[model samples]
Target: MTMRYDPHIPDRELVQLADAELPAVRSSEARVHLENCVTCRARQDELERARERFFSARSEEFAAQVPAVDSSAALLRARMAGLASEREVPGFWSGRHRAALAGLAAILVLAAGVAWWMDGYRRYPLKPDANLTPGATLSVSREQLCSAPEADGLRVIPAALAGEVFHSYGIRGPKPRNYEVDYLITPALGGATDVRNLWPQPYSRGAWNARVKDALEDRLRTLVCRGAIDLYTAQREISTDWIAAYRKYFHTGTPLPEHARFFKDRPWE
Candidate 1:
């Protein structure tokens, strides 16, 4: 039999469903509910649309950024020629020295593979987990968010709330030096100061790290205040995918030069 339909599914569960992270049985039940209930189906459709927008925008952006095949082939030829010369070196592969060198090569290859995997896996949280951080915001009007004097700097997240964010993200031990607890929707744009809006964004693990996102937040705030874009639109763009928003606003596939130079890989204090 299908599940009861008295109460609506919680948003957290729906988010998990949207992300395809829910357990099989629970996912099946949610799908059944969605098929039967218009309200839940509509909410599910909205979440799917957001995901579609991110995927569609990201695919288009990366397609335009791909390097030319001829350039890649030329680089490969140069590397292969260098390898050939190294292999022809006299006595380079002799006896015990060869064995030692082989072992070292194996270790180096393993190390490189692990580093590549990690860089691909955790270079940065490309997107915050929707179930954990769906973005939160203050109930402020555009005038309040804009007309008010900007703070001298970012406000310090409360120790308690910071701890909560770490716990929610399943992070253990001391906070990593390369990550910053940042808002999904920045406070400058009226984001709330809650754990739900906060995440441990990598500081400099990749080109699209916290520093790059900071530039986007600043630009969006400026555009909103100047009436160039609606406040809600600014919030949605950043909240959905700041990198996509960055590309859209800056009209560049990569972070601007000034933004790239703005912050170094400094350890978080």
Candidate 2:
């Protein structure tokens, strides 16, 4: 005999039954009722058939509208969709952009450290030592240095060596134009030719330079030869600290000697 389903079953419960959304007890009860209730069973079957027709028609319309998929991409995406686990990749040393950023950071840190260390490095207007002049080791007689028509025993260094020395002293800027690599004491005053005597001296903003020192050297030598100042006093004063001597002779810090007027009378002065 053709059996009936329950007539009292709600239309919502009938839809829920078709969708498999009812709880176990309710679903079992619905199954028992559906076996005997003909009207409700017929309604559920109609809803299921309508759902299938709707989906099939829409899927056919979508397929007609879209471009066809590449076979390889379809296969690859099918395989990827089946994968249950996923792993994340990080941007690290492997990535060029990340690596470049890391390298820039390292360089910045190194520059900061260098700046911090260099902050403590010795600065200038250097203090003069009283006992030893760096260049005053008299390899020759006082007569040879003092009486010679020109400077004696001053070594003329090659440009390459001069560049090396300038860089070694941490002096930077433009080349020979900005600096004069000169004797600490001029070779005319018993200064030696080695590195000890050679240093880079900057010319003053206006008149004073290595040339002015040449005049001072001549003046000192003149005073020494004339017995106005003893040769030892001249040598000691020039070598121990020539700038201090320059100040002393020029300063009205004490009474100026009558001989000091000779400097003012020079052609350039």
TM-score (C-alpha) between model 1 and the true structure: 0.56
Candidate that scores best on TM-score: 1
Stretches off by above 4 angstroms in model 2 are 1-133, 152-155, 205-209, 251-269
Candidate 1 — which residues are off by over 4 angstroms?
A: 1-124, 175-177, 263-268
lDDT of 1 by residue, 1-269 (tens): 99877667788888898767899999999899888999998887787678668866787778678763333434444445445545655684677776566555545555555565544443356667778889998999999988887761557777788778777766666445667788899888899988889887876566887888877888898999999899899989898878778987875679887896554223344
Cα lDDT, all candidates: 0.74, 0.54
Quote each prediction's TM-score: 0.56, 0.40
Please, what are the lDDT tens digits per residue for candidate 2 over residues 112-183? 544543432211113222322255546565566556776322446566655654555666653444545655
RMSD of 2: 44.0
Q: Model 2's lDDT to the true fold? A: 0.54
Pick by lDDT: which candidate is best? Answer: 1
